[model samples]
Target: MSGERRESGDVRGILHPGEQARHRRLTRLTVGPALSAFADRYWVVRWDLRGRPAYRAEVLSFPCVNVTFERSDLRTGGFVNGVCTTKYVRELSGEGETFGIRFTPGGFGAFTGMDVGVLRDDSAPLAEVLPAAAGLAERVLAEPSDERRCGLIEEFFAGRGRAGDPHFALVSRIVTAMAEDPDLTRVDQVTARFGVPVRTLQRLFRRYVGAGPKWVLCRFRLQDAADRLARGDRVDLAELATDLGYFDQAHFTREFTAEIGMAPSEYARAASPGQSVAR
Candidate 1:
């Protein structure tokens, strides 16, 4: 599975064309057994760039947390990454490998034993979050084979007891609906259709998903816009803005630039086939 496509099937909103090949080498697999109840998939990324200069891999993050084993120049180890509500960028140098368990929206609530919202835009050492499993990172990363690492993570989560909650399913439904429906770009659309009151929606998202429903809706909208532009579709800013529920083109450009790190027109040009981000 290409890293450019999230396990949720959303195309990554930010892609550095120079790094597309390496990203495609990523391995992603769905979880089996009860762990599947909590996670979307397990992913492994290994790259060996002995003579090549370092590259920065960027992706507009999805609204889910990850339990990961990674040895990097910066991280040097593993971490429990909370849901990131902004663009996520990782600079890559030398050779490194990472294995991650990508959770469904709100799926992390069970393992945390607390409101998942607190973890939004943050990451903690596994030891800190799950003291009993402080050593799991080293143990997992010790294995060179990604297949073994997958088993290790699966076994670890399987024994973690049943951390199931109805809220997990509820959150999944809410996020899935937003991702699937382009027309569902507004909070009121979700409120009126899903029957979740604004206050309740805000509280649940902050607790389970770590972002407000409005943020999640906008996130998906941006994802859609990015995917379309990446396909080389010539888009009109005003029309796109209206479709995305922005009041006007200026508002749309501001929000898209803030979230995606480039104006839509610029991103579209940079992502064209056979093009790469300028060095």
Candidate 2:
């Protein structure tokens, strides 16, 4: 299957677009309506390396959880990966396929009452995270059709019904606003705009999104910067920094380099077609 380019939303986190063709194909699908309240999207990744060297795909993660069913020469199982606070890396080799559910930020908390913060930077068996999903990995991996796999996922969550808690809905709205409004560079802006107190906002995020609001804001801004640079856009660094609410270019550069593993200018050049990046 050919890789589907991202249709909408920011596509910055998935790195080395030029190298994707050499290793794998990724497809993203929408969730069925009944499960849409909890899931943002379903993603399928297939790769065949055979005799070729393995490719490491690096990603900047959002404040969301991912439940995945993977079948490969390396392993076959279901895993729940919580909101990651740092760069996420995956190595593809031999041959493998994976089906994944990316829960909306704070959405997973609707299903399980556990404080999302405890799962940060951690991963666990799906059965451990959601006992209702026991054996789901085997069922999904056995299906040859992607459509059917989606159906199975929908059936699993649809039976649970909609999330009734008003807190999750409120969390979703706040998180969505943070992602969409570039001018919202400060937590106070979020508090003021949404009429949520600073402490309450932080507490809600810790329990539901697994990260603090300030961290989420910075991640979104940096993701935007990476996307622009990867597109080889001739952006003015200082201007872009100011727009992202950074005090100055130097601070922005420091943070970007630390998180993305490369300076902005270097990333821009590496993203140029035919240019290579030393990861």
lDDT of 1: 0.75
Kindly list the per-residue Cα lDDT of model 2 for residues 228-247, writing each as its tens digit.
77765567788878888899
Leading candidate by lDDT: 2
Per-prediction TM-score to the true structure, in the order listed: 0.87, 0.92
Going through the candidates in the order shown, the clash numbers are: 0, 0
**Model 1 clash pairs?**
none
What tens-digit string does per-residue lDDT give for candidate 1 at 136-226? Answer: 8998988876666667777776767456577666878889999888778789988898788899989889887889998888888887777
Weakest ten-residue segment in model 1 by summed lDDT: 1-10
The C-alpha stretches of model 1 lying farther than 4 A from their native spots are: 1-10, 22-24, 161-164, 273-279
